[model samples]
Target: MIVRITSKFGAVDAVHKTPHTGVDIAITEGTTLRALGEGVVDRIYDGSANIGKGLSIKLDDGTQLIYGHMNEVKARIGEHVHAGEIIGLSGNTGNSTGPHLHLGMKATDGSWLDPTHLADKVANVNWINGPITQIWGLLREKVSEITIDGFTDYLADFIVAFPVIAVVSGGVYALVRILSKGGATWAAIGTMIYGLLIVK
Candidate 1:
């Protein structure tokens, strides 16, 4: 799963029978929601007084995740969603006091399990390419913040420099390939000869 749910699961509300079944995540309405792992969409529901617009997806491992209170369901029933794929947008459509995401999980036996338990499995992004994921997230945020002029300036500089870099790199690669066919001593001799030739 994506491991991006910002809030922990809590006790189900006895009155709602909903909160008791799922965890409420504090999210802004319309925030993009993503699948935590590759899964098939099992169900989709329109907004009701309680559940609102929501979707249920069964993971490859047979665990089912329930996402509720979404503003829009982007995935369709029986569609396969890849890991980290955007499945919907969060919202307060059902019986919610505020905008948030209600998430629930079920085991293969069809019994409701605290989504938190599954979340625990992904608690440590640091262990599973977490740093790279974090870097990518940060980079996305940064790139989004760039203005059109800023992007244009960077693009111009890159366009100007690219050919020069490519030419130099290609020449170096050719030299290295030629020298490597010989040995280290020959490589050194070739480098010295090339240096003299360049100077001359």
Candidate 2:
């Protein structure tokens, strides 16, 4: 059973979506958006990316669920969003022809997934549950910052290969990055506790 489909599956005016890139949910403006699964908010934008003004949530299993072209964002990065929870309002914000909700999912490896594939699945690890490792690593890539992403990833691949230094340093760095992003004032600070430390 298709929860949603194009307005015109056969007609010329039908919502023609790209092949396997996204799930086109036919909803008019002001439709309530729900979470695809349990996970933390990854990012929220006001019509920034090609997907338009939407939000991204990563499940505990590393699968990423992205909702695009929205009228409102009800979730924020780092917040543990639950399945079926309302996260936003559907609309035509991005490169869309009309008001609708585009739902897409991807694995931790960044492989695209479909609504059917998301029916029963799980995230293997909590990328956000730890410190700000991923965030700090990402920021450090932009500037001359010290991060523990490599070390953490290495440990993830070979748990015993990494020593205590990696864990301690990675945690410290992530804490600093979280503070930089925003300390206690942040909603999802828990997701970025494994970032790197910055020196100025």
Candidate 3:
């Protein structure tokens, strides 16, 4: 899913007193949030002055990821969480102008890192691949259930009238294509051809 970035790291606007420390993603209230990397929940904040109802996770590489402006926090302190695991829900809480998710990252050296730059490295879930694979499997199974004998029996009458069907279908296709050019004469001819086929 494409997420709109409401605020970018280091952007200094009227709303931000200081250079923004994190990227803000525009989201609706109660939207599910997921962990970006394998991490252990280290801190859970409740009604903090600035980051209300948020949580922080210490990643395997020692980097700390902070999620702010949440309505609910699902991960508990010291609990291990993998990438893509549900962590919380986005909300307009604590010092937020609207419903959005504030994502901040601190490097192992304690320096603030831009979350957008490292997004791909931490996001492990392939949202498109798994479901598509399952759907393809289902389609293959349905196709396999269609036996030649069963198909032949189902369309036995059509099979006997194949030559006539082919000729009529070809004529209809040609008539429609010619009609696309727009003329009363072609339309009349198409109607007559259709009527003849229906009568036959």
Candidate 4:
């Protein structure tokens, strides 16, 4: 979890007389924003009346994190961001009264969750800098790519083969009945028609 975090959840603002939606980390403008976890950048929206310039990241565990009131967005849409990577910069944007980073978290269904819990849950893992580690990481990424390709091929094969196998088996059963009834020629024609119907 982030021990360097500043604000607490549900912190009330005296001027606006309302509780905040997420925790605010007071920081100077252009302060580097780091990803609390590994996730893909889901959205990067321009500043608005409410959130200002903000970015949304969807984590591997399906949690959606929102970093609002940014001075700049460094992450791109659909880009995979690793934990501790600089995703953006902090600033007073949107409806904010001062410079701060507004951190919010949501469940898979978009239900609000306490941002503190997520920060507390994440262990700030230190990087092991070495050539071997770098090589291993690259190889792991390649393995993941290959795994997805294999699954796609398997699914495609099953889709193409299932109906044909079912039709052939049914035709064989029909042919057996026709042979027993002394109607081999008609049954062979019917089997061809059945095969055509299956193809269509």
Candidate 5:
């Protein structure tokens, strides 16, 4: 995995899905949407372009990405923008169902690659602390990410070690009490140490 996962700002209603030209990612509305790369705002459309209330930025990389159904636009037309710059906010404006960014990346030669494949590379810095390896197992249908198999082992180890530790210390204290004090004067110390050491 590379980095951030950016996609559809919301759900795609029936009308949008009828055409079925994009993918949907469930996210919160108004999450700070960022540019995947340095780009010039080719055009900022608010329910004007065929993309529906979205904006398109033509990056210097010779690739353009269309961000649709935005809640707010932060970039202006013909403005130079850097990668990871806040470009818009997620919203359900036009032909969108929920809150998520739907991106359409176009190459100079006109080829489309799956966004999910490169989602990590362009994602936010949170990827550094992402539990992707552990999370993927949850999405992939693993029944035992956190299993009780080890709990019993750990508890058993603790149980077995506790008595030995307590007994050794308690025996030393009791021996010291007997040798130092002698007679019935030290009898209470032996019983006290033994009682304190044995829990069950």
Candidate 6:
């Protein structure tokens, strides 16, 4: 369940005099927040300041990851948390205009780093493989709502149709390849067909 990104890192808006330091992911209040990677809870602070109730984790690489504007903090200081582990709940706390999770990253040198592309770096890390996985469980619950008999029937139909689909796809590929190298006449015909099918 990917949520909408309400605000990106370095974005300047009415509320910000300088560029925003973190990415704001719009989520409903009480939405579960997860750790970005294996880290130990280093700081947990509550205040009416911009960040509101916040939590910081000291990652293995010596950098720190921060989660802010949380309605609740689940991790305690000095507690070790693995990737995707629940650390808090999203909220419109502090200076936030709406409910969202403010995720920030700090380098080992104590400089703020852009966290917008952090997902790309951790794309291979499955939430299901973590100790506190919730995504797959939620997906399972949704999938269970569908009838098994209907799903199996669709699967069977797909299995029966796969060979025909494969043969047709292979033939199309062969035709395209041949047409691509077939000098003038075939190229003209292929161009006409391509224009009709793809280029309108």
Best lDDT among the predictions, by candidate number: 3
- 166-185, model 1: which lDDT tens digit per residue? 56545655677776754544
lDDT at residue 152 of model 6 (Cα atoms): 74
Residue 152, model 5, lDDT: 65
> In TM-score terms, which candidate is top?
3
Pairs with backbone N, CA or C atoms under 3 Å apart (clashes), candidate 6: none
List candidate 6 segments past 4 Å from native.
119-200
Candidates ranked, most accurate by TM-score first: 3, 6, 4, 1, 5, 2
TM agreement with the true structure for every prediction: 0.53, 0.51, 0.60, 0.54, 0.51, 0.59
The TM-score of predicted model 1 comes to 0.53
Where is model 3 poorest over a 10-residue stretch in terms of lDDT?
191-200
lDDT at 21, model 3: 87
Clashes of each: 7, 21, 0, 2, 16, 0
User: What's the lDDT for candidate 3?
Assistant: 0.70
- Tell me the whole-model lDDT of each prediction, alpha carbons only: 0.66, 0.58, 0.70, 0.66, 0.57, 0.68
Off by over 4 Å in 5: 1-20, 48-50, 125-200
Tell me, what's the RMSD of every candidate? 15.9, 19.0, 20.2, 22.4, 18.6, 14.1
Alpha-carbon RMSD, candidate 3:
20.2
Cα deviation of 94, candidate 6, in Å:
0.7
lDDT of 6 by residue, 1-200 (tens): 23346688899988767899888865556666778889899999684678999899999999998888989999999999998887877777888887667889999999999988764333223233342233333334335545888567656766676565556545655666775654544444433333222110
Q: Which sections of candidate 2 miss by over 4 Å?
A: 7-20, 116-200
* Model 5 lDDT tens row, 67-133: 7777889889988988777787766676664445566666778765445543444345223334443
